[model samples]
Target: MTAVTKIFHDRLQVILDNHVAEVRLDHAERHNCMDVAMIDALLEAQVWLAERVGVRAVVLLGEGESFCSGLDVAAVVSTPERIAWLLQPDATGMTPAQRLALGWRDVGGPVVAALHGHVFGAGLQMALAADIRIVHPEASLALPEIEWGLVADMGVSVSGAALRQDVIHDMMLTGRHLSGEEAVILGLASRLDEDPREGGRELAQSLALRSPRAVAAARRLRREAPAMSERECLERESGLQRNLIGGPEQREATRARLEGRRPRLA
Candidate 1:
């Protein structure tokens, strides 16, 4: 194993090792709830990760009992200036709050979110942005924004499209809590595990063994296929394949298979 590099942000801790980065929310005393600082840290972390092409996989988890308890409503509402900053739109017309969740999608490669305990509102939206979600069977998952007199605005409009319309509507309208098992059955979660953090780490480590280029291509194809026409989809698929077919990583993968050895992909 390689030595890990740990970077601490305002309310987050990022550990980088051998192409896998663990992004842990560190405000455990408050169930790792998203206050202004936490949200800022999240967005900042994404910016950091975006520049590191060596980071092939990311495992997103919380430090303590819960992954996140969603936004700290009273805290945000108390500071008028913070609210304005949170809602400030960037060049893409996406508010900081929206990017805090959606930015994970653009962070170079795959993101595997480990969900346990309280995963609500903004927290769930953040998880939904990940390519894979490993959820604890007993973890509580909910939209919970309706109860706070707000809609699910943390990029749920984009990520929630992967889920069933009825299920999305029910969760959005009622703010009802669902178990992680139910979440998987309802298509909100990828899978259920007793220990989501460990599961996520295992999955991420496995992903790290593959070529980052291939992994990124797969993620891009999956994400963009929905909106593309069939002809465009096929063209995109072939284009991506052509880019990868004669690459060094692909050749190394072929050699490793022929040699019956594990691929040491970079």
Candidate 2:
């Protein structure tokens, strides 16, 4: 495990279990606000997890009181120097912030976001990328980018397309916050729970019990389900299967099943 640095200490944390990875946004002092460092940390965390060979699922959560309160206002408002710094790109080939919000969609395994408290602006955009969003009753979600004098560049257009047009328009234009219940009713959150963390943990555990290859294939299928044609879907399925068959992980899975033992996957 890498040690959290002061620059990104409040931004993110990663814990890799046997086959499940948990990533927590930890900037409680500022409601887990998104900042340059925080964004970099998030990108790094995802990149790290994607390269790992054993993870079958990922659970994203927030530490302390909230998931995220959106961009760090202080970082933007404090001074011209700070603003410039925040706008600079990272050196690790991290995708742009907008694309970074879509990273969860590209991960091979399922991603479940456990949201609670304030989830606004960029925060909400990040959560929207997850395959499943489980929100606590007290969670509040919104898109305040328009009010902040900016167009939402953080993949909102793509992710929000999953929701009803009117719902997306309402959040973007009005900056209206939605409680967890409201989000569920509006088809934003997948489920509601009293404690998002426990709910997320249970869900991840259940998912981990499944075959890793099956979960990955299901994720790929779900991502293309909304807009892809049957022909395109079949082509994608073929490509993914070609990459998985005889691969180290796939071979281990097959061998384990035949031997009736837990697979020791790479």
Candidate 3:
């Protein structure tokens, strides 16, 4: 018999329980910064969750006060050779930066990111990729890459958060931080919660109870629609709806509704 691979037995604190996966950034001393190692670990976490058949929802959180402060500049500056590898064109063709920002979005299930304290630069980009972002009242978000003479190359332009043009422009230009309350009003965050981690768990529990197939379908459409032309978007929507209309999950959902009971979800 083969030994089962542990989902997370390494750097990050990962827990999969009751169909909900909790993926956290645990380096508080460095303000949860994404050093080269952390970036690779995050991508590994994404792959682990994506391959799991039992996971229904994911909760992303930082173990300490902050979500992630940004990239660990010292890591690259101290050893310039590391930067070469990060920027090197790979067989997969995706830069390390892009993988770090968008890997969570590519997962099969919905992701809820709960933010607190300083969520800056790369951190903000990662949060934008989540299916839902719940932020604490005091959490601060900013794109400070420009201040460091670096472009925000981590999927910022392609993510849905870029739709809010005015907000993006101001934050990008001034390196100013947005509070969680303002983030909600501007649509960057889904809502404000006093205790974001607990809020993330509650949301995850609620999502885990929904039809997993429908949840995945909706997430794919939300992502694909934005990258398509109007006609393509409409056609994709119809095609996806056709696939889901009479599926086992849909029938189960209908039966559950008729019986006035919770659906037997994945």
Candidate 3 residue spans exceeding 4 A from truth: 1-10, 89-92, 160-162
Give the poorly placed runs of model 1, Cα more than 4 Å off.
1-4, 7-10
What TM-score fits each model?
Answer: 0.95, 0.80, 0.91
Q: Rate the local accuracy (lDDT) of all candidates.
A: 0.90, 0.79, 0.83
lDDT of 2 by residue, 176-253 (tens): 999999999999999999999889988986787666776778786776766888898888888888888888778878
Give the worst 10-residue stretch by lDDT in candidate 1.
1-10
Counting only residues 3 or more apart in sequence or on different chains, how many pairs clash (N, Cα, C under 3 Å) in candidate 1?
Answer: 0
Across 1-266, the per-residue lDDT of candidate 3 in tens digits comes to 12233433344777787788888888888878888777778888888878877788888899788999989887766878777766775677767777777778766579999999999998989888888999998899999988988778777777754458898888888889999989999989998999999999999978987888788889888877766899998998899889989999999989999999988864
| TM-score of candidate 3 against the unseen true structure | 0.91
Sorted on TM-score, highest at the top, how do the candidates line up? Answer: 1, 3, 2
lDDT at position 41, candidate 1: 87
Best by TM-score: 1
Give the runs in model 2 whose Cα sits over 4 Å from its true position.
Answer: 1-10, 77-95, 230-266
lDDT of 2: 0.79
**Candidate topping lDDT:** 1
